[model samples]
Each structure stands twice: as structure tokens, then as C-alpha cells.
Target: MQINVNLNGTEQSHDVEPRLLLVHYIRDVAGETGTHWGCDTSNCGACVVWLDDVPVKSCTVLAVMADKHRVTTIEGLAVGGVLDPVQQGFMECHGLQCGFCTPGMMMTARWLLDHNPNPSELEIREALSGQLCRCTGYHNIVKSVQWAAAHPATVGAST
Candidate 1:
């Protein structure tokens, strides 16, 4: 099957098998490997990406399902060489240890902040419940999201 998608702000068309996962299409066809494929069962949020501005686990979504939709991978969070505030927050708060779950965590955080600019700590934890980070103990991840919330202007303006 041939599918067209707006990927990370770029329009792309590719021929893919009906069974191909969106994560595979993003990594192989779109040539963007930032959206990591992990825990194929969707238990790990490592493969999360924005589908038409909402976050979805790419491993659970087929490429054909994403046809004609907008997909934003980790690579799309930046603009003109400036990192999104969430990215900066992660760095400043030491939100990641292994880095495997960083992309999905950031994507989910971005979506949360987009809808709720001032999420409470409990709300942040609830929003991140779906994503598992074996490292960092999640304290810093919550802080990172808090930092991003505190500095919403940077990310909102860029996006």
C-alpha cells in the first residue's frame, strides 16, 4: 500500500506493506530514527509520537492508519535549531538516564502542556503513567515537565 503523511512538518509518500507499523515507517521510510521502537506490545511508551497533534504509540498504529495524517516525531519538537522548552527542561532537570524513553516522555509532556499549560505535579504523574522510565526514578521527569510548564512561552511560541 502507498501512503502519504505529513511527517515532522514535511509531506512524504512511500510504499509500505499493510502490516508495517508506523514506527517502522518513521524510522525506515521517513528516515527519522528518533522515534524509537520498543516494547512492541505498547506497554512501553518508547514509540510514542504525535498523530495529528495527539500522542499515540506508533508501535500500536499501522502505517496505513497514519495515512494523510500528521505525524510528529521527536525530531519535530525543535524549530530553527532551538530546542523545545521540554527538551531544555529535561536537560536542566536531568530527566533522563538511559535516554530510551526520553522521546516518548517528551512527546507526551508536550501534548499535556499544549492542552493544560499548568498541570499540577499529580497531573503530570498521571499523564506520564503510560510511559515507563527504568532510570531517573521519575522525580526529575516530573520536575522537567514542571519546568516546561513554567516556561511555556518558549515552547508555545515555537510550536
Candidate 2:
């Protein structure tokens, strides 16, 4: 199948099987490794990506279904080699550990902040309910989201 997808703000066309999952396309075909694959069953939310500006678990989405859609991975958050504020917040607040789920978590956080720029601590927790972080215990992750909320101009800039 021939499919086209806007990935990381760039257009790409590739031949892929209909059964190929969006995460595989993003990683293997599009060469974006930041989107991780934790649980193939889509329970972990580690393979989350923005499909046309909404977060969806790529593991459950077919690449062919994403044809002509805009997909944003963690790699897309940065602009001109500058880290997005959410990424910076994670770094400054020490939100990640083991680095397995950081990409999806930050991706989710970016979506939340974009829609709700001032999410409360509990709201942040609720927004991140789908993603699992066994490493940092979500303490620093919440702090990072709070930091990004405070510095929305830096993190929530339109792409």
C-alpha cells in the first residue's frame, strides 16, 4: 500500500502493509525512534503519538489508516534545534528515569498543555493516567508539567 503521512512537520510517502502499525511506520519507515514500543497491546501508552493533533496509541492504529494525516512524535516538539519547554521542563525537573516512557509521556503532556495550558497537579495526574512511569513515581513528571504550564510561551508555541 502506498500511504502518505505528515510526520514531524514533514511529508513522507512509503509503501507499507496494511497491517503495519503506526508506531512501526514511525520508527522503522519514518525513522523516528523517539516513539517507543512498550506493550504491543496498547495498554502502556508508550507508543502514543499525535494523530492530527490528538493523542492516540500508535500501536493500535494502522499506518494505512494514518494516510494523509498529520502525526507528531516527540521529535517534532523541538523547533530549529531548540528543545520545547515541555522537554526542557522534564530535563530541569528531572521527570524521566530509565527513559523508556519519557517520549510518550512528554507527548501527552504537550497535548494537555496545548489544550489546557494551566492544568492543575491533579489534572496533570488525570491527563497522564494512561501512561505508565515506573521510574520517577510521577512526582517529577507532575512538577515538569507545572513548570511547562508556568512557561507556556516557551513550551506551547505553535508548530
- Estimate the TM-score of every prediction: 0.96, 0.96
Model 1: weakest 10-residue lDDT segment is: 150-159
**Alpha-carbon local distance difference test for all models:** 0.91, 0.89
lDDT of 1: 0.91
Q: Which residue ranges in model 1 land beyond 4 Å of their true spot? A: 156-158
Q: How do the residues 2-88 of candidate 1 rate in per-residue lDDT, one tens digit apiece? A: 899999889999999999999999998889999988899999899999998989999999999999999998999988788899999
**Residue 46, model 1: Cα distance from true site in angstroms:** 0.4
